[model samples]
Structures are given as structure tokens and as C-alpha cells.
Target: MTARTARQRLRDDAGSAVVEFPLVAVLIILIALTLIQCALVVHTRNTLTDAAVQAAHTASLEGNEPEDGATRGAQLVHDRFGEDYAVEVDADEKGEGVVRVRITATFPLIGLIGPSGTLHVDGHAIDEETW
Candidate 1:
């Protein structure tokens, strides 16, 4: 090919880089969004677990407002997540001073294929000092 024709070909090929740049940018953006969503799910689960454990610790002790404390735990879970959260606190009846909190929510991301539609997390906290 003539040198002029070869230079023209190179110019045309250089434009392809600009076109490909946006495609790569779009893919990177999508991947970043997915990563952010995954991180948010993990953070939500951790927050729910911590709130449940805190609530259980408060409610497990024998107080004048045992039910209220338990309700507070549930409320904390609700406030952090929303209506799709469930918190369960079991107070030991044997007076063992042990409390267990179970928190669960719907896994919207992973639920599309997995049978475990629910995201469950358990936390244990001791309330031996809450008077």
C-alpha cells in the first residue's frame, strides 16, 4: 500500500481506541456497581446482627421492661433495615444469664437462584451488667 494510504489506515484504527474506551468504561462501571451492591448487603447483614445482639443483651436480663427491651431490639433491627427484617431474642429460662439473638432478612441479590432466600445472622451478647 502507498505510504499515504497506510497513514490513513492508522488514523482510522486510532479512532477505534476511542470507541473501545467507552465500552470498557461501561463494563467497569457495571462491575463497580455490582461490587457496591454486594458490599451494601454485607454491611446490612452485619448491622442487623449487631443490633440483634445488642437488643438480646438488653432484653435477656430480668428487668421491669423485659418485653419492652425485646421490642426495642426488634425495633432497632427494623429501623436499620426496614420491614423485611426479623429479630428473635431468646432469654434463658434456667437463669443461666445467656441471651441469643437471631436476625434474618431476605437476600434479594442471591435469592434469584439460591434456595436460601433469607439472609440470616446470629449474634450473642451478655447482659450481666444491665440493671
Candidate 2:
């Protein structure tokens, strides 16, 4: 190839990246935002599970009332996450020596625009026996 033709080819390819950046940039930003939203959903679920476990442990003690577990779990959710996330807390006695705690809250996807009444987390523990 001639030197002039080679130089022209180089110049055309060099500006290709400039034209491509805007298109690729939008796709990259979209992927990043999707990943962040997934992380948020996982974090919220883990937090809710932790709160339920703590409440179940508290209620399974020898002397604590079942309702206390729900209250404690609600407080934990409120303190750790926020009042908006501490939506509903329930404690149930499953059998002779088992207690279960369930927590329901709004799952955050995009800054408070998530599905309602769908997210639920539960914790179970055996009750302690006292003399």
C-alpha cells in the first residue's frame, strides 16, 4: 500500500474509538447500575434474615414470652436497617420446643420502588428448657 493510503487508514481507525465510546459507555453504565441493584437486594435479604435469627434466639430462651421475639426482631430491623424496613414481625410456636420468627418488609430495588408484600424472611430455633 502507498504511504498516503496507510496514513489515511490510521486516521480513520483512530477516530473510531471516539465514536464508539458513547455507545459503549451507556451499556457499561447500565450494567454497573444493574449490579448495584442486585447487591442491594441481597444485602436487604441478609439483613432481614439476621434480624429474624436474633429475634428467634431471644424468644427461644426459657423465660421470654413469644411476643417478645417479634418485638425484639422489629427493633433490630429498625436499628440496623431503618424504620421503613421494619414493616411486620411475627413469632410463632411451632411445636413443643420450637419457635419461629418471620419478618416481612419492602424489598428495595430502585430507591423505594420495589414490590410490596413479597419479601419474607424466617428464623427458627429450639426453645430452652429450665429447671
Candidate 3:
């Protein structure tokens, strides 16, 4: 091929970048959004788990009732995440000197809104009286 033809061929590929750039950019943006959503879900799960554990420990203490633990867990969730998340917490003895706290809430599918009663986590602690 002549140099002139080669130059024209190179120029033809120029606008191709403009079209490809948007496609690549859109893909990158989608990947970033997915990562962000995953992080949000993980953070939410961790927070709920921690709150449940704290509540369990509190209720396992001497002279504490399971209802008190449930109330405390709900309060912790409300304090951290506000009323946006409808969280239900329950505490009960598991028949082995263990107190278990269960937290059930919505799974954050999109921006902290999803199906209700989908996510469940449990926390267990030894009862102080059993020690």
C-alpha cells in the first residue's frame, strides 16, 4: 500500500476510539457500581451481626432478660442505620448455657432497599449465671 493510503487507513481508525470510549466507560461505571453495592451490603450485614452479638452478651449477663437483649439490639440498629431498616431482634436461651440473639431484616438489593425478612444473623453468648 502507498504511504498515502496507509495514512488514510490510520485516520479511519481515529473516530473508532470515540465510539469505543463510551462503551468501555459504561462498562467501567457498571463494574464500579456493582462493587459499591457489594460493599454496602457487606457493611450492613456486619453491623447487624455486631449489634446482635452485643445484645446477646448483654442479655447473658446476670439478672438480664431475653427481652432486654432484643430491645437493646433493636435500639443499636436504629441508632446506627436509623428507621430505614426494619430490623427484628429476638433473644432466647439455647438450652446449653448459651444465649442466642437472632436478627432478621431486609436484604439490601439496591441502595439499602430490598425484600423484607430476607437477611438473618445469629449471635451467641454464654450466660453469666451458668458460669
Candidate 4:
């Protein structure tokens, strides 16, 4: 029964950090990557919502057609982010003066590959005065 002394303890722990460093570093990297993926999904969804809203506004104009709104929404999604996110853009008249825009797109799981139609957003607006 005796103390190992500072020098012996230091030697024993010398290679321990080398082994632990990789394990710790890998875990940290994994966490960081997961966080980035989540952020990407959120950003894609939010951007889709924005595109839908823009389309709704454009389509709800006094004399704009629903098709025009759909086109505008698709273009906005492509221009703002990229073509990958804009899978489908649909616009229709909800009523006499209301326009609805729906956007369906795929968000990035990693490097632009994800489940299709996973992210969907809808927007509505009132048409302007036509009289």
C-alpha cells in the first residue's frame, strides 16, 4: 500500500487522452451535424412558407389568375433557395375574393437529399378590388 506519486500518475494518464480525444471529438461532431440538419429542415420549411405567401399575394391581385400565382410561387422558391426545394406549387381560388397557395417541397436531410413532400406550407390572401 503506497502512493503512486505525481510522475507515475501523469505517465498512466498520458495515452488516455489520445484514446478519449477521438471518441469525444466524434460525438461532438455528430451532435453538430445533427443540429445543422435540423436547422436546414427548418429553414427550408420557413422559406417555403414565404414563397407561398408571396404567391398568394401575387395571385390575389385584382385581375391576376390562379395559374399566375402558382407560377410566381414556384419561381420564388427556385430563385430564393434553389430548384431542389420547389417540388410543387399550387394556387387556387378559395372563394370569390380569397386566394390560397400551397407549396410542397423536399428539405435537405444531408446535401440536398430528403423525403419528398415532407415540407408543406400554405398561404392565403384576399384579392384586391376589381370593381
Q: In terms of TM-score, which candidate is strongest?
A: 3
Highest lDDT, which number? 3
Q: How many clashes in each candidate?
A: 0, 0, 0, 0
Q: What range of 10 consecutive residues in model 4 has the weakest lDDT sum?
A: 108-117
Model 4, 23-52: lDDT tens per residue?
999999999989988887788888889889
lDDT of 3 by residue, 1-131 (tens): 69999898987766798899999999999999899888988888999999999999999999998888899999999999998768889899978899999999876687655543378999899999998
Candidates' RMSD to native: 4.6, 3.8, 3.1, 3.7
Kindly list the per-residue Cα lDDT of model 1 for residues 1-131, writing each as its tens digit: 69999888877765788899999999998998788768867777778777767766666666523454456667887887576554454333224545555655665464233333566666555555443
Candidate 1, overall lDDT? 0.63
Off by over 4 Å in 3: 1-11, 113-117
Report lDDT per candidate. 0.63, 0.85, 0.88, 0.83
In terms of TM-score, which candidate is stronger, 3 or 4?
3
For each candidate, what TM-score against the reference? Answer: 0.65, 0.81, 0.87, 0.80
Segments in model 1 whose C-alpha atoms lie over 4 Å from true places: 1-12, 64-70, 84-96, 110-116, 127-131
Cα deviation at 92, candidate 3, in Å, is 0.5
Rank all candidate structures by their lDDT, best first, as comma-separated numbers.
3, 2, 4, 1
Off by over 4 Å in 2: 1-14, 111-117
lDDT of 2 at 48: 90
Tell me the lDDT of model 4 at 60: 83
